[model samples]
Target: MGLRAVSFFAIAVVSILMFHLPYREVKTAATESLNQRQMLLAKQASFGIESFFKEQRNLLRHFAHSPAFLELSKVGKDVIQEEINDHREFVKAVTIYDKKGIIKYSYPNPEKVIGKDISSQAHVKKILREHKANVSDVFNAIQGFQAVALSEPMFEDGEFVGVVAFLIDFKHIAKTYIESIQVGDDGYAWVISRDGTELYCPVPGHTGANISETSAQFPSALAMAEEMQKGHSGTTTYQYNKIRSKITETITKHAAYYPVNVFDNLWSIAVATPESEIYSEYQSFYKKMIFATVVLFAVLIFFGYTIIKDFNLQKLNKELEKRVAFEMDKRQQQEKVMLQQARFYSMGETLNTIAHQWRQPLNIIGLCVQDIEDTYRHNEITEKYIAETVDKTMKSLELLSRTIDNFSTFYTPNEQLTELNLYSFTKQIVSLLQEQFESLNINLKFDEDGTLQIRKSVFFDAKVYPDVLKQIILSCLQNSREAVQKRLRSGEISKGEIRLGILRADAEFSIVIIDNGGGIKEEVLDKVFDQYFTTKSVSIGMGLGLYISRNILEEYMNGTLSIKNYKDGAMVTIKFKDSKES
Candidate 1:
């Protein structure tokens, strides 16, 4: 073979390896990255729960030392009903149990079990056993309602006389978690005791469902918890609520566990994200990656053909032009294919989100249906009930329209670059899904140093167009929101902080979004911003949010978009050159 032929072979090998080899390495890294993130998020959720209980313990301690409880200890029957009402949300019921375990005083005048319990309660046993501050796990009360308690020994001059404690209704504590933290589609957070018995679950009907109720089901998580009791911490992936026939069908495939110290129990606050959704990123990445590979291969072929010709240079050049034209046409076709896929995904998600948004109205419509049904059954058939039902249905119909309008706005194709306020833009995008976030109780906050405000102002006002800025902001917010939601499910966010910070450095304004949710895995980090690279499953698209954001900011807006490890969280920075320089 000639020297040129040898060179051609080497170059061909290099091109193929370059295109193919990185994918395997990237895929492995992506898997690792996802695992690490799940672990971190689980830790955060556990810590947050632990902190909440710690605060509850401290509050109970303060009440034990308070003058009112002290007076009750001395004179007894010093009813602090007024004081009790002052902190109704926190203090469920304050009771003084005599050293003999007989309840002496009950606040708010309990209807049942107030003067009943002579002892045998777990908190009473703990006070008898340890003779100190104690917290009890959720248990069915004599009144048949689930309740948890915190108790502390009352002392006059350090002499143990009785136990003063607070009784909390189950709904109050459970609802706090329910209303706080956004759990994506079909995602739910639950708390199970150290013994693997569910103490709190958002699904009211399913509370106290024994972890081993269906021994045939949930074997993995049940076994993992058994191992966890041996002092294991971090995330463990398992499957629950699955029937063999429904494997990968109706059953939720992935469950993440985080051990939280809520009260005395080593409560596992688990948030299960459907594997289908969490792994959607991977599928998205794969599709985009395949597309990128095909395009890259075509480009390499064109490059090789352009430089080296087996025929006359003139004839080969003519053929090269035709091949280049064909490649361009192919690229356009590929883009069209990707867009169609995007539209299909978007259309599906749009429908799902719309359904979620209209749940209230739909429920109201159901209520109306029930009312008419009830009226018909009762033989009333009054105009009052009929009018009420019609009014409600009409109101719901209007809400449905508004929901459709909101979705229409979201689904509208955006392709313009116009002037935009960075802070305002971020706020607007977040506001678009504020209801969803509020329902999940996920905290999303934007921060900017006072000194850095000028830099951001300059960047948005620079030679950069408005549409690019809007697209970049929209993409960043969406990613951050998804990451936050994912972490919340993994129990990875403490205080549920999703912070966006903008800073000025070296004549560039850096817009950074940081979340306490588990940090991105190093494997996922490398190709996270790559075009068409995604970690999503059950969704189809170009996975172009980060890629497009990067392209717009770096290529068109004359700025740089980069992602970096931010301690225990992920930080994405978009650096815009100073307007003065531009």
Candidate 2:
């Protein structure tokens, strides 16, 4: 009797616990899903706000560069008025400031602000001196209303003319974007300046307030502001008020914030949604789970009186499952490490390419130095000549710096797939290799059927690994160079010319590289892509070029690579699945 009673009680307790496990899991999943959604919503809202400001700035830039605006005096007053009026819904006014900070022109010509010297403003000085566009800090402007400003500098023939400054009404941005967000009951969205000043919040008390105070005057607001200041997007929780049944309840809510970049200015969007709303269904789940536990306990007590053993066997089975899972995880980690190692090994090729690219610029700098001495000896070293030489040297150094950056990008692994315009990609790779090939008197032309225009070709855009694509093209160019030299030595051809062709039709794009060197022998062509197979002298080339390229295209990019003979020359074609079709 004692054993039976103990078994029944144990069964009832276990069943009750089992009945509530699912409810706990469901609650956790719901919380995570809602938090993610909240963050996503915050990001989208931030993008929208940024896009709005970007468009506005672009519009001002266009206006500043237009011929009519450039010759402001030649254009009619109505033209300026019409322009400002068109954007008046969001634009408070437009003012033009010359290099001296003097207001050259103003739309609406407000009596007090029209001739006001704004050169004293920090942002105005920044635009004038730097010759760059900028967004100003929020301020109390005309009619004592809060507003922000954007300025785009104007230049004609590379000489500074003035700046086009546009004032934006803070209320417009809030009403159009911030106030429109629909969070749960008592939830809202707001915008804050980079300094944490509340620029646009639906709550009247919070608007125009600064939360950057170090003192814990308002701890919740301070925490929220600090999170937004961290940049990009993130989520944070703090104590907040949730009013219900005519009573104020202090509860915690999740807040997500995303930063917006306008010109050089940084602003942020914050969305607050009640944590209770995220798990409101949990209350019902809790009730149903309790009822289930009661029923399960009663059933187990009546029918599950006998204790079940074999816990040792069950534990052994669990141990086996854990061991299998651990092995799988370990293997996955090893595979990842191996892939990274392969990428690291490719750095040797990247370094060599960088060396080839830097040679020209370094030679230019050396030439400039030699010229300076030669000119001084000849008594022809004028200041103008020195300045010109220095300018050329600086330009060469800039090119070298950019080449270093390109090399860094060339081997970066795990890049996202992107749409590549066949013409642009071909042009960039050809340009990079053209200098090296030209040193050997080889002509490398990237064209399509002799009819494709630069930057305007519609034929070859596909999705693939850009770094791998660049590496493959570079390899082909190097091979083409060697092929030309081989034919020249054997008295097969006098002039060396390699043509890279871009071809596209119906769901695919192909890159074809053809060299006018003697075609490969039938026997050699079959094994040319094999690892460590080389025809060039030891000092000139390594044989991994075509082999690695084929592996990359086939295994990683879902593409095929093939080489064939074409009119007494070799032609290598790489075909890719077109992204547009996909």
Candidate 3:
């Protein structure tokens, strides 16, 4: 009887603790979840606004340096009109101001404000003083709308000549990013400048009012505004009075605010909701928790015996998971080893190519030495002759040194992305293998197509892992050399030809290599890129070249490697998407 009484006492204590403990925890968790949600919304809104400002600033800066703008004549006015027409969604008007801040031209009603002076404006003064780009705070514009100005100083021959500016529609930006944000039924977003002037607000009268004056009635809001003005991001609770349907009421609100940094200005975005809305469902949640507590106690008592059984099963599962993880790690290590071995094999091939490159230079140096000796023995070695021979020998030695340096650069490991002109980069790779191809009587050529020729004026720059790209190109060329050599030995052709061409598209470009060694057999073509699948003798290759090259292109460079039968031979193309593609 005593043991039964003790068991009942323990159950009551556990039930009481679980019931009360969870209520506080659940309430705290609900508040934190709301805070986090609001903060995320604010951050997203700020990011969108900042991006818009940055893009506009860059556009203005680009326009400021254009040949038309530098002309500072009627041509500059025409250019401003073109910009406004092209970007009508965000650009309301464009104005060009002389170095003294007197408006020289304004689009879409230039006569109204053309002769006006704006040197008193903060952003205009900043441009004249600093000769730098500036993004202004929201202000009333002469076009009778709220807008922000992005201005850049224009320079001619290193001297500041004038300023080019764009007036962007602030309301349009807010509607797209901030006004569309809805945290809950009553939650809305607003933006304010660093000076506390409201840029966008759902509240009708609060849109353009400074928060310091409008928030006087709400002390908590004043305090929160102070924090926001300092560029601090956080969550807070405040109280403000609002009128709905002719009834005035004071309501508590929760808010999260974040800062948005544009060129030289700061803006704050706030997402706020009524406190009643945040806790509207809490009462129902508490009622459910009460029922859950009773059910949970009964479940605990019934499942006490099964807990030990499940614990052992969990232990077994954990052990199996560990074993699987270990095996995966081991397999990854083995792949690394295989990759390294493939690199070493490629290095050996590069070394052989280097030897081919050095042979001519070495021969030239040897002939120079022999000429010097013969000249000296013949008593005809004048100062001029000795100097010429020494100069010739030095040139050959320099050539040999340059060959080693190029090879060293190719083998060096560089994992960082580098911007390179594809035309020049490919030319470098072709130069490396040209000698090796010539030694085998294979003609390797690099050419540019019509698209590439057109693109040359604006140079095709690609971000790539240069060393890895060089290695892959060399491997592809080596394969072509071997194929052509086979044809040469069989007397199928007097000269073997391989062409590497640059092909450009609207949003991407390709490096295409074509060889006339007879295409791969249709049956084995599909398996060419598979690991360890080689048509060459085992002594010559381990069949990892194409496989590894494809993997690197896909995984490291975000590119594609493809092969197809073309004409009498095979065409291999390495393609990368243009980074500038939007």
Q: What overall lDDT goes with each candidate model?
A: 0.62, 0.72, 0.78
Candidate 1 lDDT tens digits, 1-582: 256456545655654454445445444454445545555445545654565567767866776777667676533344456546776775667787777787877776655545666578666877866777777877886556788787888777877777878776766666654334334566566666766677766555557776666334666767766755544565556765533454644454344566665545566666556565655555764676567656656655665665564445667666765675575566556555654554455455354456567889999999888878888998999788678778889999999898888657654665555444555555555545555555565666667567656655554443345566656765665666666666677776644556666555555666777755456666666776554367742011123466556755776668888776676666777788754556
Per residue, candidate 2 scores C-alpha lDDT tens digits across 78-178 of: 66687678878778787887888888777776465666688888888898889999988888885578888889998899899988888888777777656
Q: Per-residue CA lDDT of candidate 3, range 1-582, in tens?
A: 346346545755665565555556555666778999999789767866776777788788888888787776777777778888998988998888899999988888989898899899988988899988888888998668899888889988898899888889988888877887787789999888899998888988899999988888899998998888889999999998878899989999899999998887989999998887877766765675566556545544433434345666665545644553464355345444644553454356676688889899999999998888898799998899888888989999999999889878766777788777888778778888787787778888888666667667456787777877877787787787777777789898889899998766775878998988777878777788764468852211224578668877876777899888888778899997765452
State residue 148's C-alpha deviation in candidate 3, in Å.
Answer: 0.9
Could you tell me every candidate's TM-score relative to the true structure?
0.46, 0.51, 0.49
Q: Candidate 2 — worst ten consecutive residues by lDDT sum? A: 302-311
Highest TM-score scorer: 2
Stretches of model 1 off by over 4 angstroms after superposition: 1-45, 66-79, 110-117, 142-144, 202-205, 241-255, 262-264, 281-582
Q: Return the lDDT, model 1, position 274.
A: 56
TM-score for candidate 2, residues paired by index: 0.51
1 versus 2: better lDDT goes to: 2
- Ordered by TM-score, highest first, the candidates read 2, 3, 1
Displacement of the residue 44 alpha carbon in candidate 2, Å = 2.0
